[model samples]
Structure formats: structure tokens, C-alpha cells
Target chain A: MATETTQVNVLTAEDVLKNWQGHRRVTRRTIEAFPEDKLFQFSVGGMRPFSEMAWEFIRMAVPIVDGVTTGKWEEYKGSKPETKSELLRLWDVQTAALDEKFWKIPPHRFSEVDKAFGQWEMPGQATIQYAIDNEIHHRGQGYVYLRALGIAPPHFWERD
Target chain B: MATETTQVNVLTAEDVLKNWQGHRRVTRRTIEAFPEDKLFQFSVGGMRPFSEMAWEFIRMAVPIVDGVTTGKWEEYKGSKPETKSELLRLWDVQTAALDEKFWKIPPHRFSEVDKAFGQWEMPGQATIQYAIDNEIHHRGQGYVYLRALGIAPPHFWERD
Candidate 1:
């Protein structure tokens, strides 16, 4: 187990925000790199239509972070928007929030217990990390689809 | 730019440790989640080979924290192993070092710029988060390959 100390540190928060935004930019580029025809149609088992995955990305972040700060799922914003541009706009807002709110997190909150997905109970920070990991997991699949569709995505290592 | 605090917060260290371990577990699971044949064979064009990407996950972490504590890339020890298990053994060692060495970093040192990656310079913490994010980005691809190979991966929201 890790130890807890007296003061707060926001460096990880800042770095997380930077990495998160970089992810958003590259992922958005992945989406735009695909053809409209394949974006909605390509899937391995007809699982997670690319269009739905894109929309889900918008809904995923706010609710997870809201749960972190507020400790209630109902505090999450309303439903995701239907259009792609609207989804992108919503994503931009939350990504910016991650940066702005980085320093606002209270110390020792990493160990704060929280409920997730209506059942899973774990640390608040774990929940947040899981959410981020989940999105990246799906986006990776989207990368595969893009490649199969003959589109070249941004390089794996390039952050900007 | 983020402000520097001389205060040492234990929770931030805990979170960093958690993130470090989580990254290790998830990357391992991502590889385990793939069938052996698919693990090394799959990738989008111009994407790093899957095995190479896995090594990159281990390669990226050491120097960040090394730079933070030692302030020099000369202290970085990223010896590439010839086989997979050897690579994992090295990964386990470095991750433990991250848990041990990085926690010793005073809060004031977080803002210290570390030319950790040789070409890229960032706050010591950004180096750590970049490693995490980069691993997640590639692991996301691992999940896609899992699905395509007729293997069902655990839900990302669920921790095992």
C-alpha cells in the first residue's frame, strides 16, 4: 500500500491533464481520418458502432469526474448530444475542465471510496483512472478499424 | 504554468504509485488479453509492432523518475531484453524502482524540468504521466485485437 502525507501535490494532475488533452487531440484526429462510410459501418461483431463509441466518449468523462468531485451519479450532466460536432464540443469542454480543475482536488482524496457503474465500489481516483482507461481501450479498437479502412492515423508516439 | 509547493503530500505519492502499478497490471492484462499469434502480428500500418509497443511501455517510465531524483539521463537504465519474459522481469524491477525512488521526490522537485526523454523536456511528473498515457494508447489497440481474435476481454470498468 502507498503512504499518505500532509500537503497536496498537483503535478500528476497537471501532467494527467496534458496527457488527456493530447489523447483527445489524437483521437479526434483518428475519427476525422476515417471515411464517413466506414465510421458508422465498420465493426468486428457489430459491436460498438464507431458512431456510438464516439458519443459514449463524450458521456464517459463528465460522469466519472462528477462522481469523483460530487460523489453522486445524478450530479453528472444531461445526456450526450446526437451530432458529431456537438460531441466534439462537449469533449473539448470536459478536457479543459480536467486541466482547470487539476489543482482543486483535495489531498488524500485519492483513497476516498466511491460507487461506480451502479455497483462497483472502489477509490474515487481508481474510478477516474478506470474511466480514462476504458475510453482509451475503445479508441484503440477504433484505430484498428481505421487501419482496416486504409486510413493512416497519427503516429503512436507523437503527443502533439 | 503550475506553481511549485515545497510541501510534501503523501497522497500524491500514493496516487502516483497506484497509477504506476495500474499501468503495469493493465499493460500485462492487455497482452494477456490477446492471443499469442495476434499479440505480435497485429497493428495498423506505420503503427509500432505490438511487441515493440509493449517494450516501449516499460522503456518510457524509468528515465522520468530517474531524472526527478538523479537529475540526469545518465542514471537511466533502459536495457532492452531479447526475450519477452526477460523484458517483463526488467519491467517489474523498474516499476518497483518507480514506487521506491519517485516517492522520495520532494514536491519542490516536481517542477524541475527533466530532459528525461532526450528530445522532450517536461516537468518530472509530466514524464511519468506521458508514460502512462502512451501505454494506455497502445493497450487500447490491444483490446481491439482481442476482439478481432475472438477473445472477449474483461470490461475495462471492472478491476481484477
Candidate 2:
């Protein structure tokens, strides 16, 4: 009888983080592509302005990482930025925070089930993936908004 | 000396398929949410109507699967379906074809770099991931369209 084997470790923790950051880079470009005024004001088809969507990403992203690492869920209660520069500044800060805290999570924790923010219950990996997927979803909306405004959004495939 | 062991097989082939199909189900609902007249004509901010985006997905998705399985790349050149029912029928058919061809791909091939359609070059897994991500991206636009039309889109989180 022949023995069968499964391929393991197709992706590493580092790979996951880098993949997410790649998407983040593209999202940052999406932010920059917007006219400062339109970033907060322009919306399509009753969708929230891109800035509001961006705030959603900011609120969920680093907080989720923090919750995953420290097992302390703190709801983000920060005020929305009134300017694109302010928003970008906060985005940069959280991006740094995300990198710092993401490393503190042990490899084992990613597979363990936990309730993020004491609400959504899922494995840690799914929680992280949801954050990424949500960003991509909103970014798509941003793209439509940009096109409507006669601006071309960043290329979706240029994640890096 | 202590040895460090890496976790392997965190996700299996089946998990990947189920994840993609879950997104597909939500996208299918997005199709159903549209009024028949608006399904092909509605637009937001100069973006393509939902039907056109759906055609883009149909063009890229299963053909990529076929290319992955057979190592033959043929561009999808079928004409767009004019009616929403015709469109949904094609969507369902492709969904079945996707499942059928997805499994024919060997696990090892997923990690190999190949140019899908002789253009984009990446690992087979990334290619497939792009297809799913692209769907989510366009579906986000569909959500905005639905809301603009005073129709509620499907719950994005209800991917199961």
C-alpha cells in the first residue's frame, strides 16, 4: 500500500501579514487618489462617503489586531477626521500599530476561536481575514466614486 | 537545541472552494436583488452597470479554472446575456463548472507560477484568489447600486 501525504505550510504567518499589507498599500493609494474635498463628500448610489468607509477600516483594523494579541477588546471611540490629511495621518499611525501588535500574536492563537470585541465569534484568522475582505469591499466602492468624479482609482492589482 | 516546527495545512483545498462558493452565493443574491430593468441599466458614478460587471466575472472565472486544469488558455468570448434570468442561468452554470474543474487541479499546481490566459503570471492560488477578490470588489459596487435604487442588497456577512 502506498502512503499519501498532504502539503503543509503553504502559507506562513509572515505571508499572511505581507499579503494584508499589500492590500493596505493599494488602499492607501486609493485614499491619495481622491481629491481632499471629495474624499469626505463624494458618494455614489447612497453609499457613505469614502472617508466614512475609510474610518470603518481604521476602527476595525488595528483594534482587531490589538484584541487578538492582548485579549483585551477596546471599542474604538475616536472622532472622525475632518480632513483627508488628518485621516491619512491616523491611517499611518494605525498601520504602524497594526504591524507592531500583529507580531505579538503567537502562531497558535490564529486558529483558536474567539469573540472579537465580545461580539463576533470566529477563529482569530477569520477575524483578521474579515477585516481585509471588508476593506477590499469598500475600496471597490471608492473606485466607483473615483470614476464618477473623473478620477482613476489606484489599480486594484497593484497591491504592493 | 530546540527545534521550531511550522504549522501546515491551516487551510485545505476544500476550505478554499467553500469560501469562494460562499461569496458566489452572496453575489447571486446581489443579482436577484436588482429590478429587472435596472439589472442591466443601473449605474453609479459612471461605473458599469451590475450586469456588465457580472459578465466580467463570467469571462474570467471558470475559464481560469479550465486553464489551471488543462494548461490550455482560451479567452472567454461569449456574448453577454441581455436578460437578468439569462444572466443568472449562466451564473449558476458557471458555478457548477467552477466546482467541477476546481478539483481537477492538483494541490502541487496551486503553488506553481503560471500565466493565466498567457498574460497575468502568478501562483495558481493567487490567480484563483484574484478571481474571488474581484467578485467581492464588484459586488461592493452592486451593493451601492441596490441601495441607490432603494433596494436592500443581501447581507454580505451571510456568505453561507
Candidate 3:
């Protein structure tokens, strides 16, 4: 008797993208929950304001995709948005860009190692995972900030 | 002309375990950085003390592993530790248990969808990802609490 072995892909490229976007949706809700004044000025225990952290997410996200796909690493030259509305506008634009550019990645490239932005060296997919992880980490800080401000954050589990 | 294609496994079960353990290492250092008095009693913006949040991580992590592997869900029945030392002791023990039990999972099981704790329904691997994401989330809150107490947290990226 002979036996055959087969391999299964645990996560597909589309699945990874959807997971990242689900997290983005929850984070967008976190931004919406913030009071306008506190979005840029609030800090607890000396952490930066939530707006600054959100800017960090924006800086790394789509640009990372561009780097992974095109091997073109462009430093973010955009000015920071001073108000909540402007911030949301940029966020929406980048969200669309992420959806569009992410598909351009060849599926085989996900497992290929690359030095993202000539800095962190990891699998292309891991770099993308880092972006998602970083957002969740900061959003947790935003939740703390929201509670301190006496506002409830968007539910952590309700990523959709 | 003929063409052949192959599937690539982007992340293995061992890789997932290592990633989770790396995050746990960073979270452990965070627990070590807290002032002993503030671990259980400190709060910012009305969040729970860092120790309470740590307990939430402990309650969910290894038990989720057991539930996934054995299809037997056990509610955490242990009493909360009163001091940081006791807390770390339990953390270390559970950390060891996680390594041992994670291997018991059949590889195909990673993609099998089940309702974790009879509540959240997703692939077994995703349930594990949620555990890691939740820890990162709470640790961000811990970082805020530490800063408010005039303490510095461990570097966020140095998981090792």
C-alpha cells in the first residue's frame, strides 16, 4: 500500500488582505470615537496623542505596499493633518489605495524576503502583518485614552 | 507548452508559535518594568490596573490552546495573583504549557473552523492570532500606565 501527502495553504493572499482591512475598519471607528480636541492633544502617561499614532500608521501602510510590490521606497513627504476631518479624509484615500495596490503583489512575493524601506528585513507578508499589528497596538492605547476621556471605544471584537 | 505550479506555505505552525512566544516575551518584560505597587493598583483614563489586564491575557491564552487541541473548553478557575512575582510565575508556567500543547495540534487543524469557547467562530489559527493581537492591545494600555507612573516601558519592538 502507498500513501500520498498533500499540503494546504492556511491563509490566502485575499484572506490576509481582508484581515488587515477588518482591523482598519475597527481602527477607523476608534478615530471616530475620539473628541476632536483630544484627537491631537490628548496623552496619558506621556504617550503621543492618538492622532500622531494614527499618522504613523498612515505613513507606513500604503507606502509599504508600494515598496513590496515595486521595490520603490518613497519617504512620506505629506504634511500631517491638523484636524480630525482632514485626517479621516487622508485615511479614506489611503484605504482605497491599499485595496488597489495590494492586489498588484504577485502571490509568490508574499513569502519572499525583503528589507522593507531599507530597514526592517522580513517576509513581504510579515511586513504587512507588522503594519496590522502596529495598528492594533496603538489602537489599544487609543482605547485607554477614550476611557480616560469618559467615552467608550468602538468594541474591540467588532472589526466589521 | 506545459506549466506547473506549487502552493507555498507562508507561515507554519512553528512559525505561529514562535511569533506568539516573541510577543509574550515582550509582554513579560513589560510586566517586569512596572513599579511593584502600581502593577495591581494603577490606572489611567479610568482603565484597570496593569495587573488586571495581565490577568485577562493569562485567562485567555493557554486555555484557548487547550480548547482548540482537545475540543474541551475549560473556564479559567484559578484565583488572581496578588503580586507581580506571583503573576510572572504563572505567566512562565503557562508559557511552557503553550509550547508543549501547541505541537499537539494536527497541521490540518490550523485551517479547520470551529467556534472558540462556543462563541467566536473562525479557523483555529485565526483564534490563535486573536490571542496574540489581544495581548498586544492590552500591553499598549500597560505602556500608558507605566508612563503615567514615571516609568519607562520595554522597547516595543525588541520582542527577544
True contacts kept of 3: 0.49
- Candidate 1 chain A has its poorest 10 consecutive residues by lDDT at A1-10
lDDT of 3 by residue, B60-103 (tens): 99888887777777888889999989999999998998877787
lDDT of 1 by residue, B1-160 (tens): 3343112132365566566677677676666665555566665545555677787776667666666667766433566665556656776787677667766666666666767747768777666666776777677676666666667765554333
Model 2, B1-160: lDDT tens digits are 1112123234445656777898899999999999998998989777889999999999989888877666788988777899999999999999998777777776666777898888999877778778988999999988888888889889988987
Q: Model 3: runs farther than 4 Å from truth?
A: A1-9, B1-9
Which one wins on lDDT?
3
True-vs-predicted CA distance for residue B83, candidate 1, Å? 4.2
- Model 1 residue B16 CA deviation (Å) reads 1.1
> DockQ-based ranking, best first?
3, 2, 1
> Would you estimate the TM-scores of all the predictions?
0.76, 0.90, 0.92
For model 1, residues A1-33, the per-residue Cα lDDT tens digits are: 223221336444445555556777777777677
Give, for candidate 2 chain B, the lowest lDDT window spanning 10 residues: B1-10
The best candidate by TM-score is: 3
List the candidate 2 regions with Cα displacement exceeding 4 Å: A1-10, B1-9, B77-79
> How high is the TM-score of chain A in model 2?
0.92
Candidate 2: chain B TM-score equals 0.92
Interface RMSD of 1: 6.1
> Which regions of candidate 1 deviate over 4 angstroms?
A1-19, A44-47, A75-83, A89-111, A155-160, B1-11, B33-37, B44-46, B74-83, B104-107, B158-160
True interface contacts reproduced, per candidate = 0.28, 0.37, 0.49
How is the predicted docking of candidate 3 categorized under the CAPRI scheme? acceptable
